[model samples]
Target: MKSKVIQKIKLTKDPISNFDLVIQAQKGVDAEMAFEISETLLMPDEDLSLILHLSTKTLKNYQKSEKSLNPIASEQVLKLNELRKKGEQVFGSVEAFNNWLKKPAIGLDDAIPYQFLQTSGGMDLVMEELDSIAYGDFS
Candidate 1:
């Protein structure tokens, strides 16, 4: 197994609004930014590739070349970042949120939330679950 060595880059000191993320997504997400998001969410290349509809080899190639992903993938990256923030808020910590992600959620038809992250629709469902949790609605 290849070890991941994350070299963190400064994203922004100020909070990024949804409008800013939309603009950034339109501009494209570069390899470094994607990697940063992966690190933030504790996701390995394999998982991120699945969510981005890319292969691990391609993700490595992009990292090697510092290539920027197209708009759609870029948007996915930003959405993941946003989800990470919301999850932390809902779960009280990133570690807790990550743990929750790996388990089956009754609200999601007993599917692991991590698996749901692979598609936009599934991501929306995961987000809704988080919202429900935040609002104290466990059912």
Candidate 2:
């Protein structure tokens, strides 16, 4: 039997299907991927750095060397991706979700959801609020 060359894949194309892609991620996200995520979220470099708990110099070093993120940072990236997917699901569009993120939400104590996206637990709370929105139980 001829040996088949299996190509490495991105694990999951959609966040809904593979919500724990971060846990499965071995190589983690690369610098290029990081940059793309930042662009997708419209996050400034400083904010990205804060969320990843990385210093500006460390980020610069990664970019300068074109390295993959550490597991912690990779996990954060996955969390962000999950939040993004959930946001789109709730708002019907990414643009709409982004706009909603900028506006204060009554469910979240009138805090902008975007401001709390810096951590996984915070994102989880945001997702919970989104759930409330979906169920028309905004309390």
- Count of steric clashes across candidates, in order: 0, 0
lDDT string for model 2 (1-139, tens) is 1001001122233454344454434446665556566777788889889988988789878878877788778777667776777778777887888888899999998899889978878988988888898888753
Candidate 2 achieves a global lDDT of: 0.71
Report the C-alpha lDDT of model 1 over 97-121, residue by residue, as the tens digit. 8889998888888889999888887
Give the per-residue Cα lDDT of candidate 1 at 52. 89
Worst 10 residues of 2 by lDDT: 1-10
lDDT of 2 at 132: 90
Tell me how far the alpha carbon of residue 2 in candidate 1 is from the true structure, in angstroms, after superposition. 30
Quote the RMSD, in angstroms, for model 2: 5.0
Once model 1 is optimally superposed onto the true structure by TM-score, how far is the C-alpha of residue 33 displaced, in angstroms? Answer: 1.9
User: How well does each candidate superpose onto the true structure, as a TM-score?
Assistant: 0.81, 0.77
* Candidate 1 backbone collisions, by pair: none
Which stretches of candidate 2 lie above 4 Å from their native place?
1-13, 16-19, 25-27
- TM for candidate 2 is 0.77
